[model samples]
Target: MSFRKTGAAILALVMAASLPVAAFAEEEKTIEPTEVTFWHGMSNTQEQVLTELTDRFNEENEYGITVKLVNQGNYGDLSTKLTASAVADELPDLAQAYNNWLTAYTDKIVPLDEFVENDFDDYEDLVEGYRAECEQLGFIGALPFNKSTYVYFYNKTMFDELGLEAPKTWEDMLAVGEKFMEEKEMPAFGVDDLAGFLEASLAQNECEYASDEGALFDNEAGLETLEYIMGLYNNGYARLIGEDDYFSSVISTQRIGGYIGSSTGVSYITADDFELGVAPLPTNKKAAANQAGTNIVMFAQDENQQAATWEYMKYLTSTEATTEWAMKTGYLPVRVSAFESDEYQSFMADDITATAAYSQVDAFFPAAMFEASNAVRTSVNTMFEEVVLDELEPEDALAEFVQIINEECDVE
Candidate 1:
C-alpha cells in the first residue's frame, strides 16, 4: 500500500477497536443488575418516600444494579452505626452522611470525582455553590443527597389574619414576635434547639461561628450571635424545645406562631392538618443561610461494588430522582436541574412555602465545616438556655460563651 493508504488503514483499525468496546458496554447492560446497599438516616414518612425512590430507580435503570435500602436510624444513631461498621470493615456500599461527618469519615469514603467524570459530564450540573465547600473538605468523598437550607416555617393563615408580612430582619422578627405573643397569645417562633439556628443566622450576619480559616471560634460575630439568641429567649419570642421533638406540633396545634427550621421539615408537616408557610430564615441586612441535610457517601468496597454503588448514587441525585425525593420528602433538590424540571416547578407552584424555600437556596452556605468547628456552639446553647429560663445574666452568659468557644472551637 502507498504511505497515505497505510496511514488511513491504521486509523480505521483503531476506530474499529474503540467501537467494539462501546458495543460491548451497550450489549453488557442487559446483564443482571448489580446489588447495592444504601444505609440512610431517614425515618417515619421520610422513610416511605425514600424507599419509593429506590424502588423507582430499580424499576427504571437498564443497568442491572439493585439497591437494598436500609434505615440506620436518625443522625446520631446512623453515625454511631457507621463508625462501628467502619471498624468491623463492614460499612454499607453506600450511605447517607451529614456534611459535618464528612471530615471524620473521609478515610472510609471514596471521593466521587472519578464517578462524576465517568457518569456525568458536568458535575456542577449535579450540584452547585456548596460543591466548592464539599470539594474543600475532599470533594471526592461523597455526593450531596438530601440537602436543605434553614427556612422560617410560619403559619400563613395566622399571618394573613393578623395582616403580618414575613418578618425580614431580626429587629422586625422581634417586633412581630412580641406583638404576636401580646396580641395573638402565641409564642412568636419555636425552635427545637438554638445552637444550629443561632450558628446559621450568625454566619449569615458575617459572624464567624468558627474562624473562616477554621482556626478559631471566638470572634465578634460569634459573641454578638449568641447575644442575639439571648435576645430572642429573653423576649420570649422563640420557645426552646428539645432536639427529639418536632416543632410542627407546636405550629399545627397553634401553641406557637411559627418556627425556624430546615426546608426538609415539610415531611413532618404532612402529619398535621395546618397551613404552613415557608420563608428564608429571617436575615440580617446581608442575607445568608447555612446549608443542612445529608450527602450520599461511599464506603470502602471492592471495585465491582464501587462501580455499582456509584451508579445508584448517580441515580439518587439525578433530575428525576432528586425531584421525586424533594417533592415527596420536602428536602431541597441539590441539583440546579432539579429546580428547573417541570415536576419541581409545579410542586413549588402548588405550595407557597416550597416556593419560599426554593428562593433562599442561592443565599445558603453549607454547614459542612461546623461538625468539627462548632464544639463551642453547644456550650453557647447551654448558656443561652440558662438565659432563656432566667437562670443567668445575658452578658455573664455571653462572657462564659466566649471563654468556652475560645477553648473548644479554637483550632490551636
Candidate 2:
C-alpha cells in the first residue's frame, strides 16, 4: 500500500489558510538575546557535526540566539533525564525525542502549530514521509531530525562465491537461509531487534501490531510472521544477536550471510576481507520498512526561548543542514529538497549503500505507537526469545504475549 498521506492532509487542513493580516502585521516587538538550551543524545561523529552546526547557528543567525547543547549519553539516558527534569520543573528549552518519549511529555511540550503557521515558510519542502511521521499522531509533536530506515545487509562475497542472489521475499529468505545453514553449517540471518522486524513483516501482510482496540498481532497474519521466523531458528537458519553488535558479529565471525538492520548502522558494517552489500528489506506481500530516528522536540518555556528554539529547529532541518547531516552521518535527509540537492546527489553517488535506503522511502511507515510503546516492544522481544530460544509454539507464545501487552496498555 502507498505510504499513508492522511497525516499530511490533516496537517495541511490545519495549517493551510493564513492567519488574519493583522496577526502577521503586528509583530514588531524587540526582544533581548535568548539563550536556548538543548538536550540531545548524540555522541562521537554525530555529536561533532551537531556541535559544529550549533556553533555556526549561534555565530551567524539573524536572531540573537545562543544554543547550548548538552549531550545526555544515549537516547534512553536522555529520556530518563528529561522525565526527571519534568518532575523538577527543570526541563531544557528543547531536546531530541522519539515518539514514545514525546508521548510521555505531550502535555509539557509546546506544539509547533503557531510557530509553523507564522514563521516557517518551507514546510512543503520537507519530505512527505518524514513530515507525515512528524504528524503521525494527528499533530506535529516534533520536527524531523536524524531519520533512517531498515535495510538488508548481506555478505556479497559469500553470495557471489555461492552463486546466490539476495532474497526478495519471505519465501526467498527462508529458502536462502536454509541453504546457507545446510551448506555452511551456520545461521544465515541475524537480527538485533525482533520488534522492528515484526513491524516490517506485519506491514507486508497488511497488518499492524497495535490498534485503538488493543494489540493486534494475535491473528493468522501475526502467527504466520512468527512461524516464519521460528522456522528459520528451529532449522538453525536464523539467530538473534542479543547483547552483541550485529555489524561486528557479521564481520568478525563471517558466519551469518545477511540480516535486516538500520541504515544508520551501515557505516559500522566494515568488510575489508569481503564485500558488503545493502538492499531494502525483503518483501512478502508488500514492500514496507519501519522509519527510525528521533525528532527535535521543544518543551514549553517562555515566549523568547520558544521563539529561539523554533529558529534553531528550522535551521537544523533546513535543506542545506540536513544534506550536510546526511553526508556526514548515515541517516537520511529529512527534506525532499535536501534529497534533490547537488550535495546529496554527490554523496549518494560516492556511497551507493546510502542510496539503498532512499529507494524504500516511499514505503516507509511510522512505527507502532502507544503510551507504553517501549514496554510493548520489550514484550514482543521477550516473546521472540521464548519462541525462538525456548522453542515455544508460535500460537501459544503469541496468545500470552497479546494478553500481557493489552493489559499493560490497559486496552479494553
Candidate 1 Cα deviation (angstroms), residue 357: 0.8
Question: Which candidate ranks first by TM-score, i.e. highest?
Answer: 2
Q: Write down the lDDT that model 1 would get.
A: 0.73
lDDT of each: 0.73, 0.81
Model 2, position 145: C-alpha lDDT score: 96
Model 1 lDDT per residue over 1-412, tens place: 6999999999999999989888898756333457889888888767998888889878887777789988887888988888888778889998888656545556777877776776664677755655756575656667778887777888877878888888888887888788787888667787764767766766666765554344233556656665666677677777877553778666767777788877666656752555677777788757777677778788846877887787787777778788888888777787888888987898889976678777876777765364445465566668656667774555666666556655664533
Q: Which predicted model would earn the best lDDT?
A: 2
Off by over 4 Å in 2: 1-31
Model 1 weakest lDDT span, ten residues long: 209-218
